[model samples]
Target: MDVCVCTPQEWDTIRSQRADALDASLESLGAQPVPPVFHTTAAPDPSPFGIQNDSDSERDPDDIPIFGEQLHAPSQSPTDTLRNITRSVRLNVNGVPRDRSTWKTLRDFVDERTIEDVLDTIESDRNALDDILARTSDYPESLSNTIAAIEGSVPAENTLPSMQDIFQAQGIASTDMASHLESLAAHFEQMSTALEHHEAGETFVHEDLHDWGTTWAEMNRDTEELPAILSEMEERLVSIDAAQWVPVLSQSRELSNVNRHSTKLVATKRTAQQNLDAHRRILDDLDELGEIMSEMLERQQAVEDEAREHVALLHHHIVTIEDLQHRFTSYQYAYSKLLLELARRRQYRDASDRIVNGMIAQLNAMTEGTFSSPQSQASTHEPEHGQYLPEDVCLFVQNAPTRWNVVPHNQELEVLPEIDSDLLDDARLRVGTGVAALGASQSL
Candidate 1:
């Protein structure tokens, strides 16, 4: 059975028709009639209402046909009888209209057409919605396959050497990927929808979309008209008991603030933890480096001490050579003086030999004895082969002491005290003095 309900536009049309008929009846009876209006005129709703103009016909808004159009009274279409029209002319003028304030939000007020329209919209975008839904349909299979592939291709146990958390990597789950794809598809669909709506010449006003929430909340009811509906709503909002909700709202706000701060603090804690870990690792490396440097320093110190000892030995050798050179110079001077004295003594010995020879010749003439001087006999004097023979005197004469000192630059010069001849033994010197005295006496 086909059933339909009248819309507000159809109701208004019926009311206007009734008012006109009532006005006509009162004029014929010669009585003043109420103005032919039930409510103030307003712009008509644009939504279709399944009714057309019947120019010469009269209808009533409150009159309803139940079950079907078969019950409608087709015989009273015109009502040409003046008696019947006059009898019904006394209508209530101050009758209260239907309460339409709940028409938008009440569940019983919405018509079937609005539900059909919503269903139609859903049907219109079915393909796009299907495409979005299809993305996640394979989630279970895909996730299982991904896990299987990972298990097959990659070992679960870490194969690489341990990094000790020195590095990090990020991974996405199959479900996450599917969800991301779904979101992207939804975004594309929304963009396509918006573009299509824009191209269809629809205005971008909030009023066009705001009516859906009202239409959706409503169920079944005739829309009502009121002179001060908007004003009553304003008063309701202004007179709300705000004192009852202030603490709840404040607590919610405080909770939100605490949550925001807690999130920030958690992030700070994570960042600080990362910093501490990195610093600890760096500190470990630095400590190890410090230990290595300390060991190197100790080894270097040992080498330096050894080098200093070697330098000291070399310096001592250099000083001993210099002292030996000074003594050698003094011996050379003494040896030259000894050679001079030897030459002088040899000349004196020759003169003494001549005098002794003369005395011997005279004694031999007197006593007729054979006497010969020592020089007239064979000498057989072997050459001196001892330390007295200085090594290569010609080498000292030919070469000037070009590098007598072998001291290096920056090396300290060692000073030795002057040698005191009194420190020598007198016995070693007296033999040399006695030999010289005997030679002197023989010469005299």
Candidate 2:
């Protein structure tokens, strides 16, 4: 019959060694050796505005300007020009009045002097005139033309016009200038209010454009970094896929099954231990009964030598025999129960053996012939090959039968020495002639 060959200690040792080896191999497979650390000097910073400082040949081939001169050029539309003019006027007089002293200079010069007097004054002070003209040249052509007309109107007599004429001219010119300045101031105020409203309207638009540019820059940065981020994510996914998840899950399931089996085995062991204790108690009772029976037999023999106590002794012997019969019946019942328990234990053992054999087969399959079966170890100790028993089989000797005997036939029986005539007669009186003769023949 097949049986487990390895002792508990041997199995534990084997499993521990295999487990250690597996751990080492897994460590080798999972370990990522530290790469050599190389010290690198920092690279130069890129230009803040994204424009490369490199020469034309060294510049990135992919870099291209997004904005050209045309994108920043002023608009040609009359409406756009009007808007620009209004914005400029508003900016120039943001915190001051449109009719302030700075603007009164033109009206004052025209009011205080005639066309001729202003020319003589400018010619007499040419250096100051040069400075004023130099600063005033930026004004409109109309203003310049008015200045030239005043210079040409200068009298050849080099004398001022009459006070009466000057006053009349000043009154007319000042009234005209004041009227024009008032109109201009009113127009400036209207344009300034309109520009303020227009600028308010454009505020959100400008902010939106700024935000869009910022978003575009952020998107560009993210696009540049996308490849490395994707690569890292892909590597992590691959590592997850490459992990021994299936094997680990399978092992976990197997361990759970083992635990369940171990629980059942523990219950079985408890039952076996109880039965063993019961057997020990029965054996102790049997031993005590045997001693009692020996003493009773000695008392019966002692009484057989006393004729006066023969009747009482006979009565006592009969009672002792009945008690002995009852004890024997109890022993028989206990032995039957023990035998039944032994049968159940043998069945359990057989199931365990089957389980172990299946595991061994699985182990062999998994290892792909790298590991040998225990049966191979059992075959090395045939009587023809060696005197020593197989190690695995020897381990079983402590619990298994050492030797077996077959029942012999009449012809195979050996002759025995003759029994005494008196003893033969006494056995015949107790067992009857036919049984005595059968026993005698069997002995012979």
Candidate 3:
């Protein structure tokens, strides 16, 4: 069965028609009645109730049959008779000429349209509530498992603290993980729902996946940004602490004399005096050696003077041999002339040639003998070969000595050899002086 409820416009139209009918009836009965103009004046305006003036606006309440339509007694419209209108009017029967008419008119205008709309709104709200309840009831087991896994994966340090621990640590009484999550949990709840919807391939009204991704991205960005700043700050604090360490350490450890050691200085006195006494003895020995060197030097000088005189005497004997060779050549030339004169008479030519040739041969033999002999070497001893051959030559040879003595450059003249006649006539005079001296020195 299709049941129809009357709206307020329908109720008001029905009430107006009923009131007109009653007035018509009372007027026909000849009782002093409400005037027709007054009835028009008394009718309620539908404008305030959001009701439109159209063909559907005016109709009789009983004309459409429904339950509860008889409360406006003589009018027969349920809206005209409802007590809520009477209560809103706050009126008594004494003020109106037709009490029933006013009562019916007020009752008819009891907002039936608003009531119908309210009922429709309530039915729709109920359906919406039922749909939400069904969706929540069928929440996927997979979604629950995913949530459990994600929660379980977090480490102990990252996980929220227990209720008692949070209270102790933060000094907040009765605070818990749920209390902390209250501010942000709705966003995660929404994200979880959207992720499920997206996985299911359903067209979601809100992009919960995008919201979840953005939230996770922001969380990761914060995680990345915070530690780098904190690390830098921690390093700066470490450097600051390091800067203060040297003074603190020096203050804790004081200076001490444990690092020092003893050293001694000694001076010796006897060594200098001993060295001086030794040096004096060395000087006395050197002076004695110098005197001996002076005596040896005088003997060396005498030997050198004698050697020079011997060389001069050898030079004088060479000059005398040159003079003897000149005189011998002259005597040979005179004897050859005498041989030529005897050969011209032819009386003893051969004998003359022999005698002349023999003389020249003898002269040549004497000249060669003198030239080859060590005549200069004989000056170092007695000149034994320079002694007499003829009486006059012997006299010259005997008087000329073989050795002489040289004078010093600072002194007078050379000392000539002395020959004593009596000494020349002595028995040693006939002996070669070098052999005789050698024999006599050997005998001694």
The global C-alpha lDDT for each of the candidates, from Candidate 1 onward, is: 0.36, 0.38, 0.37
**Model 2 regions more than 4 Å off:** 1-308, 369-444
Q: Candidates ranked by lDDT, best first?
A: 2, 3, 1
Q: lDDT for model 3, please.
A: 0.37
- The collision pairs in model 3 are 8-113, 14-59, 14-61, 79-107, 79-108, 80-107, 80-108, 388-394
Model 1 residue pairs with clashes: 100-224, 107-219, 108-219, 108-220, 108-221, 109-219, 109-220, 109-221, 110-219
Model 2: worst 10 consecutive residues (lDDT sum): 32-41
1-444: candidate 2 lDDT, tens digit per residue: 122244334533543543343333224322311101100002211111112244688766533221111213334453543343334434333322333233211112111133234334423443432343344344346445544654444433323235465345435544554454465465456446546766888553546535544343554465565566545433332223223222432333332222222344456566667666766766665576567657655654554434224333323323332332233232223323333444456566567667767776675565445324344433533434445555565564233222222333642322111222342343334334334433432332
Candidate 1 lDDT tens digits, 1-444: 112134324433543543343333223222211111111112121111212333335654322211112222223423332233232233322322233332221111113353345335434443343444344456557556655653454323323322232111101222343454465465456556656888999875566445533221221111131224323332332222223322533443232222222344456566667666766766665576567657656755665554445444333333332332232233323433443444456566566667767766665664432223322221211133324456654333323222122333465322111111321222235335545533432332
User: Candidate 2's error at 170, in angstroms?
Assistant: 99
Ordered list by TM-score, greatest first: 1, 3, 2
What 10-residue stretch in candidate 1 is worst by lDDT? 32-41
Task: Score candidate 2 by lDDT.
Answer: 0.38
